[model samples]
Target: MLHATGSLLTIDVGDRSVTTTDIDDELAAFIGGRGVATKLAHDRIPFDADPLGADNRLYFASGPLQQSNMSFTGRMSLTGLSPLTDGLLSSNAGGYLSRNFVATGHSVVEIVGESDELLAIHVTDEGVEFEPVPELEDAGVPAVTDAMNDRHGLESEHLVTIGPAGERVVRFASVMTYDERAFGRGGLGAVMGAKSVKCISFDGDSAPALELPNEDLHMEVHREAATSDDIMRRQGTTNLTEFLNDEFSLPTRYYSELEFEGAADIGGNAVEEKKYEKAACSVCAFACKLPTRDEETGLETEGPEFETVFSFGSNCGVDDVVDVMKSNELCDRYGMDTISCGVTVAAYLAANDEFGNAELVHDLVEQIAFREGDGDLLAEGVARIHDELGVENWAIKGLEHAAHDGRVVQGQGLSYAVANRGGDHMYSTTMIPEYHGKIDPEGTAGKAEHVIRNENLNALRDSGIICQFGVGRAVEDDRFERLFDADFQDLLSVGSRVVELERHFNNQRGFDGEDDWVPYDLPDLESSLQEYYDERGWNDDGTVPADRVDAIAGSD
Candidate 1:
């Protein structure tokens, strides 16, 4: 409430209209970022709306902390009905966009309606403009970005654009920002494509004024981050590759084998070896981004992060980190989620026994973007095309599984099954505790409690618009109290409400206990899963209770 502008912007591309409304009560009740976005999507979007139709709205929002100079606050949240999963999902992207978005004088921006022509919508303090650019049809991310820069002097930081993948409505297309950073899950870019909105630019001088309670904490965190020697700052998230492989959960050769003998070839050390310079988003320190280049091969990309490494490297049987790096770049340019795109390629390899064919992997990345030939079938994603391809379904609710195999980390498998976002590891992050041996990774009992707490805590972090690495991860419970000027539990309550609201929305769409499923096995799966629902005070099924929904929406 302190940082919120208490306003929402709605842009209807179909009619070329821009409107604003006061959301004072909603902001107070839901907080900002994911929380506010979820509430808005719940109440406004029709329960049976098609994920890629005009009825499905995209909400882009930043949270209270974005008003401060906090080290981990340089991220934004995008909430929408997922084309891949057919459920509500909130995806986070870290870049310079959050700062520019906050300057627009609105807590959230919603894009609605469909346009007859591909248009770029520009938002500023003064007003809005919809410019039709038919010539830019089928362009990739860089082309759209370069056009925006040349025509409007807007940089990648000021633009959120789609690529050929989105233009073709690839089921796992991604909404890309800062050229490379992505709202990588759930096909929101395809939603944009469906709406005929190719890009949106933000720059304004109407940022709301806010008072910081623990202003010094920002500097303290930044100073610590500047002096820290965290391995993530060197290799990005690839630091988890070898460990996951060692634990027999790396999902090599398309989930057939749990371990990758060549894990070290594409693990953190390999990524770090290609590092040419440091990179960070637009704010304070804690530069944990990997900007790598292979000078001999002339391949440069930000990262083939842990998930990317899993999907394109080990999962596809490719040992060369640079090959994964090229896949990473290809996905970014084409605006596809690397996890989904890589798995699509791997799924093909499974059918053809062509594992480790790096050239085919790269070619598949392009074909998926263009929706050509086999790419057209693979573009449909693993879940939808598995029967035709004659392979084991490796997807949950249509979203491809990430690197952390659920079988090895039993808790994570449970987390993946009941997750609202389907196969998204971040939904609960049970892997964190499992990885640290805080609990038995193989045990099923009592794991639900950890999943519950982590789901809420992560929801809170997304609302804070914070990263989950470096000092962001180290920021403790008490530190959060001073920063938000609110009780830690109270902040977590906001998260609980967000989670409940997501479940409520999905329930309205007919998802229940049956929909929360994983492909592989887990011990006591039904019992532990039911226990999770019981602890949440929901029915025996996974749907949120009617009373709880009212409470989450603040109607009670």
Candidate 2:
């Protein structure tokens, strides 16, 4: 088994108290990261608890592989009840935070109860310290991160901070680390804001010894990733733009169309022209993160990733590459999810016929961060915009849809409809097969099975908290089995159980077959959902049988 400190750090902001607990058998059975975090949320958070209330708990969890020699294991999972979705929410990000957080001898950090005053929580090997950071009030993410690092010294600390958008409790606010990386969905940042937390900094130096079955195999994986022909390494995630546009799956003009006339202007090749440096998470060999700088505007930022490009560039009709990059930088600095920010802005632009107005987009981003004027409504996310204005807003389970235009790709549409985390594409990348032509995009035949299998595999990958880019190669090379020293079938079984647990969480909150729907009309949706339920052994009503839940939990 992997070695860890196996400790849980609990911070009660309301009482200004801290406590620690040993990881117990029940939590251990679920492994770590997303798995253990979900169990904690299920046990501690009431199904009906206000997502932004003191009663709602926020968890930052590191996976078992974190802090190990494994490549792409530097990612972390953040979980809580989402103000946006009103159900379970788990967002993952990659950076130095996970490695240092795990090194602090705590696998999980759970925060509860709101503070009366704004505070910053600092974690070290000595213990947790809560300090008031009133000066950070209404600060942007980059400024907050910089101020904290300057105060604590950058070499020794990693910081996660919320920007003014989060300070205002905007529903889709993001928590950012390393200036650019984010726990970028589901309004978890609003949860932190509700607790009056400005930032979290970790400066622990303790490193747990990892027991690897084959160190040589671990090295081999890293070596392969460094020399691999993976597209991620070559052009980052923006490489998807050309392919998505070619397949007519790119979201353009707020999902009004699938293809953009200016798609090539903001695609991978365009991003390369502005690329200044390539960055990576701790020990990750892919180095997929491209930090770019605009020569004309002197704007510097890390990404306008595939999703960001779709959200701001095509979706909002702002096709200028530099403008999209600037918008992405604004979202990062302001601590707002680019997907939500871009989509919300797209909704406004579409209603107003202000497409391609870069100046208006910039002004709106600032307004939303500060909750100024109409930006207040926009900051609430696309669902609220749809409710208030009766615009053509598309979302699944309250959260805004990702970059992919589901209308063009039926399997992707189905994935969005049934995804536990609303319209998130990362839940299960069903579009992979369709993109490669292994499956027909329009055909619904066997799509449910494809999604189910992908979800289970994705659950496994998320539990390890591995970067999705490394997943295919990892599985093909049997890296997971060798790293965990467990059978592949057993690992897959655990992953299936995790997926069921997530479904069970949603089911308890009264989600049913009706709730699983694409915002746009799909003729074959009913049949597809029925097939999905049948394939997963769920009831036709989309509820897992009680026995099935028990069986999955019992398997743990």
Cα-based TM-score, every candidate: 0.98, 0.96
For model 2, name the residue pairs that clash. Answer: none
Question: Each prediction's Cα lDDT score?
Answer: 0.88, 0.82
- Model 2 alpha-carbon drift over 4 Å, by segment: 1-5, 154-157, 475-477, 551-556
Overlapping backbone residue pairs in candidate 2 total 0
Among all windows of ten consecutive residues in candidate 2, which has the lowest summed lDDT? 1-10
Candidate 1 residue-pair clash tally: 0
Which TM-score value belongs to model 1?
Answer: 0.98
Give the TM-score comparing model 2 with the true structure, all chains together: 0.96
The sequence of per-residue lDDT tens digits that candidate 1 reaches over residues 468-536 is 873236578888887778888888888888888999999999999998889987889999989999988
User: Candidate 1: which stretches are off by over 4 Å?
Assistant: 1-3, 470-472
